[model samples]
Target: MRLGSLAYEQIKERLLEGGYGPGQRLSAVELGAELGVSKQPVMEALRLLSADGLVTIIPQVGCEVARYELQEVQDFFALFASMEGTIAGLAATRCTKAGLRGLDAVSARIGHLASETDPVARSHHYRLLNREYHARIHALAGTAVVGEISHRMWDLSDFLINTSGADHPLHAALDARHDDHETIRKALWDRDAGTARREMELHILGTLSVMRPQQL
Candidate 1:
């Protein structure tokens, strides 16, 4: 990979993993030291991440992790759920038998995560595994354009979920989240597009509840 791309991926990884908090200042010089590169590449990376809505770059103030208000987060997830529901519906109609098996494998891995003891580790791994589960659905959708658009949104979703100022986000509800996945999987296996779409929408909106444990 190119230097800029490498810097971009590493920085984005930290943001999604909660290595950086929402609105936390991101010093390019410090990051360059850690990445063993100059500030230039890091700045380029931040700029790209900014475009992805994971970072905020202000001309005079420098860079920071992107932050959104509570209402913004709510609005984002609502829009996100609708888009993902559409993709799930597409996946239901178009996925091959082999593709369905691959999805089952990923879902099983997520199920295993339910037994994990560490909340932080479980949340981190769940974020990754959950992405895989949805990415499999995106692949089954068979539309590169839709997949590309959905993926950009997914990146933002991760940044929001992991950086939502909640140390235990999705940590306490592993079983419920896993149960949501099972229902979606069964719907997909049955090739029930209507059920898949509705189930996926409900499952996604449920993310807000986990994010705010008070609701859980």
Candidate 2:
């Protein structure tokens, strides 16, 4: 990867891991020093991060990690739920036998990892499994335009969920979310578009409960 791309990935990893808190100011000079690169690469990385919705760059005030308010989170989740539901509905009829088998294998791996004792291990496994599962649906849905938009929304959602100030123990709800996968899987297997869409919509919206509502 080029220096800018490498910087983007490294900085994005820090953001996802909560190394930088939401709304925290970022210094390109400091980041460049730390990453052993010139300020140009850090600037490029920050621009990319801003485009990805992980950071906010103000013309006069500079950049800070993106801070998502409760309303913003809810709105984004609603949008994601609608889009993903539509995708699942399409996938219900579009997925080939081989694709269905691949999804089943991913579901099996997720089930196996759901019982993991180590918090880190469990989180890591679920992240991988969740990404793979949704990616499969995107492919099965077979619309590049929708898939591209969905991927961007998912990326933004991941950022919001990971960096939000709410300490609502979202991790604890992982098993419940994973369990919904079974319902979705069955609907897909049955080629029931309505059920698949409903199950997927419910599962996506369920994640909204992970965030605690702000005080009025």
Instruction: Compose the digit string of candidate 1's lDDT tens values, residues 16-104.
Output: 88789878999999999999989999999999999999989989989988888888888988999999999999999999999999999
Clashing pairs in 2: none
Least well predicted 10-residue stretch by lDDT in candidate 1: 207-216
Relative to the true structure, candidate 1 has a C-alpha RMSD (angstroms) of: 1.7
Best candidate per TM-score, number? Answer: 1
- What candidate 2 gets wrong by more than 4 Å, as runs, is 166-170, 213-216
Clashes of each: 0, 0
Candidate 1 residue runs with Cα over 4 Å from true position? 213-216
Model 1 clash pairs? Answer: none
